[model samples]
Every structure is written in C-alpha cells, then in structure tokens.
Target: MSIRPTIETRKAVPTMEGAGVHLHRAFGFQDPSELDPFLLFDDFRNEVPEHYMRGFPWHPHRGIETITYVLNGTVEHGDSLGNTGTLGAGDVQWMTAGSGILHQEMPKGNAKGQMHGFQLWGNLPSAQKMTAPRYQDVQAKDIPEVIDDDGTVVRVIVGEFWGKTGPVDGIAADPQYLDISIPPGVKKTFRIDTYRRAFAYVFAGQGAFVDASAPSGVLLEKEVMGQEVNIRDMSGDRTLVRFGTGDEVTVQAGEEGVRFLLISGAPIEEPVAWHGPIVMNTQAELQQAMRDLRNGTFIKPAH
Candidate 1:
C-alpha cells in the first residue's frame, strides 16, 4: 500500500501545431526515456473555431500509435488507406501507425463553438514497429464508467480497472488510461502498477497531490482526516504531475472539484530515434522512412 510520491509538477506549455492549431503540450521532444513508451501528449482544447479549424493536415506517422480522445465537438478523419470516420464527443480513436501511414484530422467545433480533446502518442517496440497498421475506434457509450461509494467517477478508456475492461486492446505499451473526477473536498487514492511509468494531467478545477515521502522543499503541510500530510501545491488547469515508484496515488480535490487524466504504461526502455511523427529505434531506420516517403512508398501494401 505504498503511496507514490510526486516527483515533478509543471504546467503545460502553450504551443501551436498542425497548421497553426493552438494546443498545450504537456511533454514531448525532450528526453524520451523520461516517460518511456509514451512519446507525446497534447491537449487540443480551443474555444475559437479559427484557432483549430485548420486541424492536422495530411501527415505521415510510423513506429508509434496515436490515441485521440474527444470530449467536445467532433473530429473528421481520413487516411491514405481509404478509411474515413467522424469522432463525436466522448469518442476515442486509437490508430497504430505501424510501418507507415498518412492521415488527416479536421476538427469542427460543437454548437457553442467549443472544442476540447487530447492526443497521446505511444511508442511501439522494435519488434512491432513494422507491424500492420490498425485502428480501434471506440465510442463514448462503449467506454465503461465506474462510480465509487464516495461519488468518485472514473472513465476507464484503456486497460482493466474496477471489474471492467476498456474497449481498446492489443496495444504495444499495455497502458492504462483513466479519466477521473473527484467531488469537492473529497480525497481519493488510486492503485497503479509499480513497474509502469505513470503521470496525471489535471485539466479541470484544482487538487493537491499528497506525497508523504516528498522532499522538504516542495512539501506543503495540509490537514487530511485530522492528520497532517505533506502535499505539493494545488495543481490547476493544464498541470502535469509525474509520480515516483509506488502502487498508490492520493489526491484531494479543491472546492470546485477536480477532473484529471491518469495514464500509465510499461516502459519500453529502448533507444529512440525520432523526427516529427516518425519514431524508430535508430537513425538509419528514420532515414529510410523519409526516403520511402519521398519515393511514394511510405504506406506499405496490406497483406
């Protein structure tokens, strides 16, 4: 029952991607090993249609998987493989860009001109990097939501939790993705696999992550259940919290309650050679991928 300590906390940086679409990047283009098997995460939430209408134009990706979860509005997507679909609110699309593929995602805001969603890039192991590309498109209704006795709600998007299993499966990283909401002033603890690298992205309201084992400098005293506990600062919107090795994570919601995404995956622990959307194990592989794109052969023939 060890509690995971908060190792680092930082706010997501505002960034523009995919033809001037505004978004916030929590982590990417840095030390890939820091959150092994997970390369990038972006919160593409926008209230202005002009900011996101351009969306992600046709792009090539390989050696990785892209998971797009939509909370509001809709996303229309098409791929070079001749597949087309529209993802509405609460829909999730998990695309495995094994070998290679070209795709385009165009977003359309909801009636109120609001669009919010997240995109997470997961790395594939070397053995599966050249596997056939596939897609797992799960609708919101298919995703299981569990409510605890204390009114804590958890939407299990991937992996098994609370006597339920997520719809998306056969993933390389074996990750667990959870969308959780805690009521105001409520405290909750979640169990995570100690062997996996885990992180939480706070996107709504505020909360303090309790870490009894945290160092002195970042520790703040707070009263929990009549006992004094050390916790980090109240994490608000777009905050990223990385946890140290442990099996449990405790968070106390603020007055407005808190909603966050808790994601964890088994570490790949392999050398990464990445450039733009393509991620490979070595520079030579990346170079070959670029050459393939130039030669109009990036998309392999389906078997």
Candidate 2:
C-alpha cells in the first residue's frame, strides 16, 4: 500500500498522425518501459468534420496491434488481408498486425457529423512480430456489461470480469480493457493484478481516484438533480492518468458521475524501436520489416 503513493499527474501533449488527424497523445515516444506492451494512446475525438473526416488512409502496420473503440460514429475499415467492415457506435475492433498489413479507416460521423473514438497501439515482442495477422470485431451488444446496485457500470472489453470473458483473445499483449462509469457519491474499490501495469484515461466525466488514506485526485463535488455531490472535472478530455504500484484501485464518482477507460497489461520491458505506426524491438528489424513490405513478402502463409 505504501508503494502506491496515490496520484501521479499525467502531462498532456498534442501530436498529429495518420493523414493529418489531430489528437492529444496522453503518453508515447518518450519512455518505453513505463507502460510496456502498450505503446501509444490517441484520443481522436473531434466535433468538426474537417479535422477528422480525412480519416486514416492506407497505412502499413507491422509488429503491433491496433485497438479501436468507437463511441458515437461509424468507421469503415478495410485491410490488405481481405477484411472489410464498418464499426458503429459502441463497437470494438482489435487488429493484430502480426507481420504486415495495409489498412485504412474512414470515419463517417453521427447525425451531426461528429465522431469520437480512441485508438490504442500495443507493441508485440520480437518473437511474435511475424505471426499471422488477424482481427477480432466485437459488436456493441456482444460486449458484456456489468452493473452494480450502487449504479456503477463496467463494460468488459478484453478480459474476464464477473465470470464473463471478452470476445477478443489470443492477443500478444494480454491486456485488460474496461470502460467504467460510477455514479456520484459511491465509493468503489476493484482489485487488479499487481503484476500488470495499468493506467486510466478520463474521457467523459471526472471523479477522484483515492489510494487508501491519501487523496490522490479529488473530484470537485457538484449537484446532480438536487443532490449535493462532488463532480469529477471532465475538462481533460484526452488526459492520461498513470498510477503507481497498487493491487487495488478505488474511485469515487463526483455529482455528475465519472467515465473512463481502465487498461492494464504485462510490461514487455524490452527495447522499443518505434517509427510512425510500426513498432519493433530493434531498429534493424524495423528496416527489415519495411524492406519485406516492399518485397511483397510481408504477409506470410496462413497457418
């Protein structure tokens, strides 16, 4: 408990990627071991169509995985491996680029042409970098949702929770992705494996994440339908909150509630050589990957 000394403030920085798509990167390209297995997180939420409509055109990915979760729009995607589909609101798509693949994602906004989603890149180890490529698409209804009596809602995306397993599996990173929402004034503590490195991103609402006695991030109380309650500041839309060592995580919702993505996975802890969308363990290996792509041998024989 002492090791988990409460909150560690996350610095927010803006970075661009994928054909002029603007986003605020929570953490990436700085330290490789701090949050291993997971390399980058981009909050590509935009109300203006001009900022996001261009979408992610044809891009090559190797030695990594892309997890796309859409909240309020549709994303039509097609890959070099002969897979094509559209993911609407509440849909999750996990693309494992084991070897190399060319893919494109074009976003079609909601009724108001407003689109919002998050893409998380997971780096693969050197051994599995050239495995067969595949995808796991989970529809909104298929994702199991657990709701507590106290009004806490959790959507299990890629891990087992309350005797239910998520649709995506056999992943190289073995990550746990959960979308959690807690009502105002409810104190909840959930235990996560200490071995896994975890972080949370506040997307919608805010709340205080408490660590035992010390107050790490306190939620400013606000009124919710005449109830005197502290509300979490949702001002930081793409803010990344990295936690210290702790087996259990406790969160208290403010008056208007708190919504965030809780993710954890075993750290790769290996050296990372990242360039654009490709992530590998060695720089030479990355060069070889690019060469292989040009040689038309990136996609190997199917198992």
Candidate 3:
C-alpha cells in the first residue's frame, strides 16, 4: 500500500539484433539501478526469413538469466552442456547463466516467413552468479491459460496468477510473467504485486493502459468506430509500457483487441557489475569470470 506515485513512462527504442533481425529494445546497459535485478528486454519480430536466418550465434552468458518466448515461429536452441530443444509458438525457455555457459538460438519462420518473439534478461545476485546453470523450458501446451468470464485470456509463465503458480520457479527475483489478451472494447484490470516493479509490452494490436494514478502515457482512446487511433504517445508493435505502482492495471483493447506481456519482479537493490552476458557484484568477480572462461573452466564441476 506504500507504492509511490506514478513514475514517468519509458518508451521502447527501435533497434536491431540477432544478425539483422529487426526488434525494439526496451532498455539496457544504462542506469541498471533504475530497474534493479532486471537488465534488458528485446522484442524480435520479423516476417522475412532472410532477416532472421542468421539467428543468434553461439554466445556466452554468465551472471544473468535469459527468458525467451516464441510467439509465432520456431526457435531451435542448443547450449554448451549439450542441451537442445525447439520452442514453437507460445513456448518459453528460462535459462539461468549462473557461472557461465554458451548458447545459440536459431529462428525459423512460420508458413509466410512470419516470426515474432521476445527475450528478457533477469539479473542474478552475486551469491547465485555461480550456482549452477539450469533451464526451465515451458512448452506452449503446458502453460496454464485462464479465461475470464469477460473473454480475457491469460497465460502465466513465471509466477502465480489467480491462485495458480507458474512452472518456472526458484528464481532470484521472484518474477511474475504473464501473457494477456483482452477482446475488443473490453476493459480489464488485473491485480499485480505492489511490492514489485512491473511493465507491459504490447506485441499485437493496440490498447490503452489506464488508471487514475497511472503515468502520463496512460492514454485516452477515442475513435470514430472500428479504427485504431494510434495514440501519439505509444509506438506501434514492440512498444514497451512500464507501469507505475498500483495493485491493479486497467487496459482497454481497441477495435482490433490487444495482446501483451505483463511482467513484474521484486528489486534486489544489490550492486550489479555487468559485461556482455555476464553480471556480477564486484569488478573483481567479473574479472574472475572472464579469466575462468579464458581458462576453459567457467562451468563448475558436476557434483
């Protein structure tokens, strides 16, 4: 109940990633303290196979967790530990970098070369930076989808929702990851943990997120009929909406309806030293991680 007044909204920046893949970067590499315990979010979406085929080559991650969610196409991934899998539409993979690891993800489009997905980077505390790398691959079929009487659907991926807990757990940030959709002209407000920082990313269609205490970007939608009046404050798809403190969030879907990912997590408030895929507390720890990687012993011994 002690949540502060609404904070200013931070819009997603248009950026490219993954070998010429077009995407929007929500935030990264600057003022980590603003979003303590959580580092970055990227919305990678494309309709041309040639744009995404290059994919993400083998890369290293050490002190962070990466969550990948596929919306339309298929993403085949492999890690240094020999784990391999494919994530189809709606599937999620939460990978903990822990000590260190090498991973690659290749994207293949749907029938029309339509591919859409997102990746979020969650930071790990210093104590858990080397606590054994692991993964929770949540398949699309296994994710719990709850339908409200009003035609709203929600898919819980990382935390609890309406008394149901997500399959992925034991995370340092105790995050709540939800994919939600509201039917045309429906207004819905769902409860979120007031203690955690929360944000939403609009992926499909358009909507207005509102609340009396909501930030300025909280828009008012007025259209002639069956048309989406692109609110001047928000971009089209791949727009990231960061919310202010509130137990409940209200959203009104436009004529085309709206689909978005709503996520929240408790702030660690701990020091963060980040470089590339690795994050640690002290510079010395980061140096050690790099040295270990160079020495070919970054992964901890199997117990």
Candidate 4:
C-alpha cells in the first residue's frame, strides 16, 4: 500500500472573526485551488467568555456550505430563513448557503467557561452554486462512532468508513470527514481514496503522520538543552498536515494519545472568484452578488 507523505505542516494562526471572537484560522482566504472544493477551516476554541461570547453576528453566505462541529459548549444560531437552533457539545450543523442567506451564530461557554468547535467551508461546484439553501442539524447521538479493537475510535462526520455512513448527505463535494483518536504509542493506518485531496488537523495531544519507509513527518517531542532531540514529532495542538498523493495514511500516537480530524474531498478544479463569504466563478458575478446584498435582493426564492 502506498502511504501518503506529508507535503506541508503548519500551525494554526490566531485570528479574530464573528464580531470580535478570537479564534485560530487553519486555512482560508488564500489560493482556493490548493484545497479545492474546500475553501476555509476555522477553529473557534476559547476559555474566556469575553473572547467568544460576542460571537458571529448576522452575516451573509452564498455559493458554499458551512459545516460546524462543536466539541464543547453551545452555539445558538439563527438565519434569515426563519431557522433557529442551539448546538450543544458534540452536535454538528451543516448549512448550505446556496443562492444566498443571512445568518448569525452566538456562542455560550460551558460551566467552566470553555468553548471549543470547528467550522469548515466547502465550496459548491459551479452547477450547484445557485441551488436552494438547506440545513442539516445532526445531533451528537446521531453521529456514528466506531471503536476498533486497538482502542482507536473514529467519528464519521461525512461519507463512509468502516461499513458505516455519515448522517449528513446530499453534499456537492462528496467528502469524507473523520474524527479519530488513537491509543498512545499505537501505530495505525487509514485507507483513503487515492484521488481525493486529504488533510489532518490535530487538536489534542501529539502524534506523527508518516510513511513506513520514507518517514516524511514523525513525532519527536523530546528536547535536549532547548533543542528538539526528535525531529520526527510532526503533530501537536492546532497543527495542520497536508498530504501528498497516496492511497493510505499512517499515524503514530504520542504519550497522551492523539485526537484529530481527517478530511478528504474530490477537488473541484474550477476557477474560483472568492470575495469574503461569497465564492463565485467570476469578478462580475462577485460584484453582482455584492450589489444584490446592498439592494436587498441577494437571497432569492429556493430553486
């Protein structure tokens, strides 16, 4: 089996969004073709109420789908389409801003004043860019979880894995999103479609993703005299790993085990004209969308 090699590894950068909420941006607002079909990923994890309570005020989105997975705390959301809901810990909300829509998300921390969650923006293909807006509110209990014999747990968020399919469907990208946790010091390999673009985001503990022979990026946490004694340590909190072509990926957990999100999707490979939350095909279309927003005609009847 061909093991996917790590092409790039970088740490998430701190950024402010959603009415002054402090968060980390893993990737976004750059070359859309790099990740293709997928546009942005933001990790909104904070322990301070003032940092996140302001939350994402009313905003507009079009020509994209937003997937939000909450690890802790609650996110109260409302949209212009008269949809309102609360997403608690472990809940997920996938919103398709087809055509156009205005929405707002307010975050409330748990008793300990801790909030954690992630939002991923996936681009819609040119064909479905003007489709009807929809929402898939998946409860934590509804998401399927598989526990392997080696104590590896995988939470399938989208697509199929281990004979189980995710609850959210009818997506344009046909992506596979998996939340995985490996046992400490245990090595595990996951098979992915060779044609899909894949990436991993590490949120807890540490781990290394590498191939058997080449050793692209492995874990090396130990340090000697402030110098890293192990250059193999490739993963830690808020780390993003982009993989090269291969059919499978191998990861080794560190002492505290490793928890991360593995995601892959077919590349859209289309010309992208992105302006803030609106992603279209050309500059004129983007300008038209902005003009519609100002004219109160951005959102059209569901088609």
Q: Mind sharing the TM-score for model 3?
A: 0.90
Per-model TM-score versus the true fold: 0.96, 0.90, 0.90, 0.94
**Backbone clash numbers for all candidates listed:** 0, 10, 0, 5
Clashing pairs in 3: none
Candidates 1 and 3 compared by lDDT, better number? 1
By TM-score, rank the candidates, best first: 1, 4, 3, 2
What candidate 2 gets wrong by more than 4 Å, as runs, is 1-4, 212-236
Would you list the clashing residue pairs of candidate 1? none
The runs of at least 3 residues in candidate 1 whose Cα sits more than 4 Å from the true structure, single-residue gaps closed, are: 213-232
Per-residue lDDT tens digits for candidate 1, residues 190-258, read 999999999999999988887544545756676644545455567899999989899989998877789
Model 2's number of clashes is 10
How far off is residue 206 in model 1, in Å?
A: 0.9
Question: Which number leads on TM-score?
Answer: 1
Per lDDT, the best of the predicted structures is 1
Q: Residues 149-201, candidate 4: write the lDDT tens digits.
A: 99999999899999989999999999999999998777789999999999999
The lowest-lDDT stretch of 10 consecutive residues in candidate 4 is: 222-231
Q: What ranking of all candidate models by lDDT puts the best one first? A: 1, 4, 3, 2
lDDT per residue for candidate 2 within 32-130, as digits (tens), equals 787888888888787888888888999889889999999988999998878999999999999999888889998878998889888898989889888
Q: Each prediction's Cα lDDT score?
A: 0.93, 0.80, 0.81, 0.90
